[model samples]
Target: MAFDSLGRFGVWRSYTGFTPEEAREYEQLGYGTLWLGGSPPADLPVVESLLAATETITVATSIVNIWAAPAKEVAESFHRIEAGFPGRFLLGVGAGHPEHTGEYRKPYDALVEYLDELDAAGVPTQRRAVAALGPRVLKLAAERSAGALPYYVPSAHTAQARATIGPNALLATENKVVLTDDTSEAHSIADGTVGFYLGLTNYVSNLRRFGFTDADLSMPPSDRLFDAVVAHGTPEQVVARLTEHLDAGADHVGLQVLGDDYLAALRTLAPLLAARS
Candidate 1:
């Protein structure tokens, strides 16, 4: 059950925004994993594309929405990826928000049911992770999946999630990132990156649990919350901030660098991350 294959850092982006070219570039930059963030469909052609473009990089879904993608079809795709690429694909599954899915009731039960179907279909439990944040889902991830893949969380939440899932599960937490020395620019990007997620009750509730007040959870989250959730500053400062997650027991920091020029930022961050290695 060791997560030795996953390494300590990876790039996180919505699959729709990704290209094979970027995957190849990340591989050259020495990143270990490529995480496709949005809830992608079950066919997993995007996963194949990224995997095909790089030899050693592992590709994972930040999450394939349980309500949008059926487990049986997803399992079929998992088999295809496994047969073709073996240990290179990780299926990160989750129950999406109630606001987004028409049938989003009982998220915890839905996640369990979807995982049950995956079990029936012979998708090895070690190959998948749960997009979990709260205690109930995090515990279920610990008991059932390879890890807890939590998004939009601070290092404090990462530490708490590590505690919730215990030591064995991979606590791969996502951190929104921006590289800027200007305080205004950093705050601008940080607030903008998490603006939409602020509306989701699930993310809001989780932040509240970690001591974020109602004001801190507002549209443009308070400075404290935004700073904690997004890694920003110079390359060295950003590296230091990202290092906090690893220190807090995260198996990997899923770097969702916020900006129009993501690759440029990744390039700037690559050397700093490598130095840590």
Candidate 2:
């Protein structure tokens, strides 16, 4: 919705890893929002735990797959969570990858239909957003929903999206961060994670649209590819990179730690972001 106080820094965690208590700890750690990833099914109980744990932080779905969680079911969950914890939930829904779902066909049409269903069910357009990347979907997101929650995109793309969606529409982007100074090792970890997304057509296409070529998108992503996608360095360096997104017109940037020790990473970066705030 109007993510007015969600802050610029947020945590991107999987629901399976973070318990409600852990979520509360993150809120205390100064992260303004908790973005649950991994296409969780429509279950308000899980959302409720997150809302109950934090007093003011917002809980959002990085995305609930439109294929798996139907609009009606999502709307029902939305109402339940809203009734229990008003103004604390933001629904981020997406048409998941075609390779992952049998129902993945004409995702644009599917998203439109889902939005129509959400509308008819009384879920306000301002309370939700779509996980959009391309121009068409991005434009549709501005028209039909609150704004766009674009994942795995860079600051350059954010600049373009900001121009396209105008200044008022929300532009929230996710950046993978590794708070390590070791360039080689950091890139290795980034490659392992980047490899999966590089293989996804939607991500690859978006990267190409941003000027990376087929050679750049080749297997075992080139150093250029890795650098463009992952922002790895010291905390200051990471903050510098993330600031580019905000400068490029992002309303908020969700920082996803690449390493296993997520809480430590959050603790490390919070102060730097706080200083800027």
Candidate 3:
């Protein structure tokens, strides 16, 4: 798989966040992929809308949660999209959060079963990525899918994931970034953005990899944790923070704009972010 097909930076936003035209403009701005952030259902056709709006940007599901979207249905959806769009869609699948999953048994085993289902249904290994954070899942991703898609992690975790997954697989890390010069507003916005994730054990557990202790995991989080996970500052500063992932061996960085006026933020940010790539 050509991990570079996703380019250096992808906009990680929900399909509901932008209009079809805005999705097209993202392509014009040189982003190689549109990371549709929500765990979309099996019959998601928003991918086609984005592809039709643009000639070249890849549209990847930041993940299609395995719990809700059955593997057979998702594989059929992937097949349908692949038929129309060719190599444009990359499927990202994950075992979702334990907090949200009621019947969440052994997550690792569930993920393996899901992957086996995808494989049996004719989904090629190179066409999908696994949303992995821990060592076992990271290694499983390298062996079973295109690569790893890690969300809410700092560059330190990216480096660790890359080493664990080895050199060949894709490392697409999602970083929540706020492009604002107002320090107070940025922190406020970042705090709101991270507050919900702080309550999720999976997210907080994954964050601990970046040297975050229980104290740092408290509500509002520590400044060290905030600065590491949420990149907020002027455009150049944000770009530098995103670059840390690349330098740490990320194949692609999916930037999820953590503020209102996402299109404006992406328009303001895409060029600056693209300039670095």
The regions of model 3 sitting more than 4 angstroms off are: none
Mark the regions of model 2 whose C-alpha exceeds 4 Å error after superposition.
Answer: none
Backbone clashes under 3 angstroms, per model: 0, 0, 0
- Give the clashing pairs for model 1: none
Give the local distance difference test score of model 1.
Answer: 0.88
Compared to the true structure, candidate 2 yields what TM-score? 0.97
Residue-by-residue lDDT tens digits, candidate 3, 93-206: 999898998888888999999999999999999999999999999999999999999998989999999999999988999999888888788888888777778988888888
lDDT of each: 0.88, 0.86, 0.88
lDDT of 1 by residue, 40-108 (tens): 998976888888888988999989999988999999999999888989888999998988988668999
Give lDDT for model 3.
Answer: 0.88
1 versus 2: better lDDT goes to: 1
* RMSD to truth, every model: 1.1, 1.2, 1.1
In model 3, how large is the Cα lDDT of residue 263? 69
Q: Looking at candidate 2, what is the lDDT of residue 175?
A: 90
